[model samples]
Target: MTVEGFDGRLDRYLSEVLSKTRSFVQKIIEEGNVWVNQTQVLKPAYKVRSGDIIRIVIPEPKQLSLVAQDIDIEVVYEDEHLAVINKPRGMVVHPGAGNFENTLVNALLHKFSGKLSSINGVIRPGIVHRLDKDTSGLLIVAKTDEAHIKLSEALKSHQIKRIYYAICEGVLKEDSGVVDAPIGRHPVNRLKMAVIPNGKQAVTYFEVLERYDKYTFVKLRLKTGRTHQIRVHMSYIGYPLLGDSTYGRSKNEFGIQGQVLHAGEIKFVHPITSDVLHFSTELPEYFLEILNILRSRNSKYHV
Candidate 1:
C-alpha cells in the first residue's frame, strides 16, 4: 500500500506504517519489508522527498503458537493516543517466564488486528504499564510515540495516580498510615523484592476501608512505581496481602488464585490534549466473594 505524507521523516513514516516501535520498524526495514518507489529502503534515517511512493510490506510476525484468543476485555477508554483496559484475574499481562503464549499481548494482537504501538517491542506491543498475572484490574496502553513519551514522563514524575484495593491477611492497628521504605531485590533470593537500607526509595499510603477479624481491606496509593511495591510494603509492615505466597502469609482460607489485589483506579493527563483522564474497574467476582465471606464471618463473630 502506498501512503502519501508530505515532509515526513523516513523513520516516523515507517513507524506509522508498521504500527510498531522505531526499533521494530527498523528491524523490519533491515529485514527488507519497506520499499520506497519500488526499491527497498535500508536506512531508517533516509529522508523522503515530496510525492514519494512509500510501499510497506509488513511480514507476518514470527508465529509462536501465540494464537490471538478472543478473550473478553473491558475497555474503559480508547482514542488515538491511549487505551484503558480492565484486565481480569488469571490473565498474564505479557508473555514471560514459562508463559510464552496465551497472554494479554496475544489477545490484544488478535483484537487490535496487530495495530499496536511497538515502542515496547514485538513481544510487548503497546504496553506502557503492567500488572501481575493474578492481580486484576485497570491497565493503560500507549498507541503512539507521543503518547508513550508523555505517559512515561508522567509515571516518572509521579503525576499519574494509581490506586489499588488489597485485602491483607491481618487487621491494621491504625486506621491509616504510610509505609516509607526502600525496595530492592533480595540479596540472597533474586526472585523476591525486599525493603533494604540501600534500596531505591518507595512510599505507599494506605487507609483501612474495612476491617475483618483476620483480614483488612485497604486502599493503597503508590508514590513510586517499583516492582511489587505494594506487596513488599504491606508485607514489610506485617500484613501481607491475602493469598500472597511470596511474602509473610503462605496460606489462605479463601482459596483464591494468586493475591487478592486489584488495580482499581487510575488517573492521568492525556498525552496529546492535556485533558484529565480517569478510569476505574470494579473488583472481579472472586474478590467480591472473598469480601462477602469476610464480611459475613465478621458480622456473625461481632454479634
Candidate 2:
C-alpha cells in the first residue's frame, strides 16, 4: 500500500495499517515481498517518507493439516446459522503456537463434522470471538460465511454485549466504575499486555458485587474488545484480577491455574433470524469453590 500520513518504520506501518501481527509483517519483509517506491526493502526498520508508494504481495495461505479431535464441549444453543457454546477453563479456543490439539475448534470440528464457516481459515473455522485459555465463557460460532460477516459487523458496531465476572485482588472503594484505557503489547514482556499511551482504545465498566478486606467480586462489561483488555485495565487501576500471573501476583492461595475471569453472558442479534439472542452460563466449579472459601474466611474475620 502507498504510504500516506504515517512516517515510521515500514514494518510498523504495515502492522498497524493491515492489522497483522508484527512477526507476520517481519516475515513478509524478510522474504522480499514488500517494496517501497518500486524498490525492494528487506529491512524491517526502513524509514518511509510521506507519499511513498509501498506495495506488498501476500502469499496464499498453506493448507492447514489440523485434525478433528473428539473432545467434550458444552453446547448451550445451536441452530442452522450459529452455535453458542460454554467453553470450559483450560481449553484453548483454537489451535496455535504449542497447542494444536484438544482445543474448542477440535471439538467443534468433530461435532459439526466439518460443517463450519471457513471465513477465519481452517484453524479457526467457525470462531467469531475468543476467550483466554483459562477463561471459561460463552462463545458464538458462525455456521456460514454470511452469518460470520453479520456477527462480525455487530461486534464492530458494539451491538453485541459481553459481560464478565472476575475476582479482583483488592477491595475497590467505589461500588461501580469505568476503566478507559488503551491496551497494547507490553514493551518489556512480549507475552503480556499493558496499558500504553498509543495503544488501541479499551473501555471496561465494572461493578463491585461483594467486597472483602483484601478482595472484591466484580462484574465487568466490555465497551471495546482488545486483547487482554480486562486484565490490563484492571491492573492499570490497581485492582488486578485474582490469579493473573502476568498482570497480578504470581502466587495465590486460591489454587487457581489462571485469572478468575469468566464470560458470564453474551447478548446479540441473530444474523439469520434478526431476533435478539442471549446466552448465559454459570460460573465454573473451581471458581465457585474459591468463592466459597473466600466467603467463609470473610465471615470468620467479620465475626
Candidate 3:
C-alpha cells in the first residue's frame, strides 16, 4: 500500500507496515534494506507524506532447533484451539539460539504430548506473541490450524487486549498518557531499543495506579506489541521498570532477578466458539514484595 499523511518518521512507517519489531526493522534500514518509492532512505527519522510506497527487507534471525528439555509450565487455561498459561519469570517461551533447553516448548512437548499445532514449526509450536525471559505473565498458545488463524486475526485486529502491571523506577508526572514514539535498536548499542528516527510505530498506554517514595505502580495497555515495547517506551520517557537493566536502570533495589513487570491480564475471543475469554493473574511473589517495600516507605499506600 502507498503511504498516507502519517506524520511519523520513516522508521516508524516501515515498522508499522512490516509488523516487525523496531530493532529488527532498524537493522534492515541500517543495512540498506529499506527503500521509499524505490529509493533507499537510510535516515531513521526521515518524515514522509501520503502515498509514498516504502519497502523494507528484513532478514530472518538465525534458525534454531526446538529441543525438548523437561521444563515445568503452569497451565492456566487450555482448550482445543488454545492454551493459556501463567508463564513464570525465568521461563523462555520457545527454544532459540543459545537456549535450546529448559524452555516452555520443551515443557509443552512433555505435557501436551505433541498436540500443539505445528504451524510455528518444531521450534515454536504454538507461539503467537512472546514475553521477555524476565517478564512473567499469561500467554496464549494455539493448538489447531483454525484456532491459530483465529487467534492471529484477533491479535492483529487489536481485539486481544494484553494488559501489564509494572513498577517503574520513578514517579510519573501524569496519571495517564500514551507513549506514541517510534522505537528501534539503539544506533550505538545493538542490544537495546531506543526512540530512533528509523524506528517502528510503537504505542503504549499507561496509568498511574499508585505512587511511592521512589516508584510508581502503573497499568500498561499496548496498542502494538513489539519486542520490549513497554520497557523501551517507559525507559524512553525516563521511568524504566525496576530491574530492567536492558532499558535504562542499572540495577533494582528489591533484589529481584529481572524486570519487575507482569502480564497481569488478557482478554480475547474463543477461537472456536467466539465466546469472550478473559484471564488475569496475581503478581508473582517477588513482584508483590517489591511493591510492598516501595509502598511501605509511603504509609498511605494500599495493597
lDDT of 2 by residue, 153-179 (tens): 788789999999999998898989999
By TM-score, the best candidate is 2
Error of 1 at 38 (Å): 33
Q: Which should have the higher TM-score, number 2 or number 3?
A: 2
Instruction: TM-score each candidate.
Output: 0.77, 0.80, 0.77
By TM-score, the candidates rank as 2, 1, 3
lDDT of 3 at 235: 89
Tell me the RMSD of model 3 versus the true structure.
7.9
lDDT of 1 at 61: 55
Candidate 2: the clashing residue pairs are none
Clashes of 1: 1
* Residue lDDT tens for model 3, 38-152: 8988878877888888776666644434555566788888877789989989888898878778888888877777677654656888787889999999999888856866677
Score residue 152 of candidate 3 by CA lDDT.
Answer: 73
* Model 1 per-residue lDDT tens digits across residues 74-137: 7788887788889988898888867767788888877776666756666787788899888988
RMSD of each: 7.5, 5.7, 7.9
lDDT of 2: 0.88
**Predictions in order: lDDT:** 0.82, 0.88, 0.82
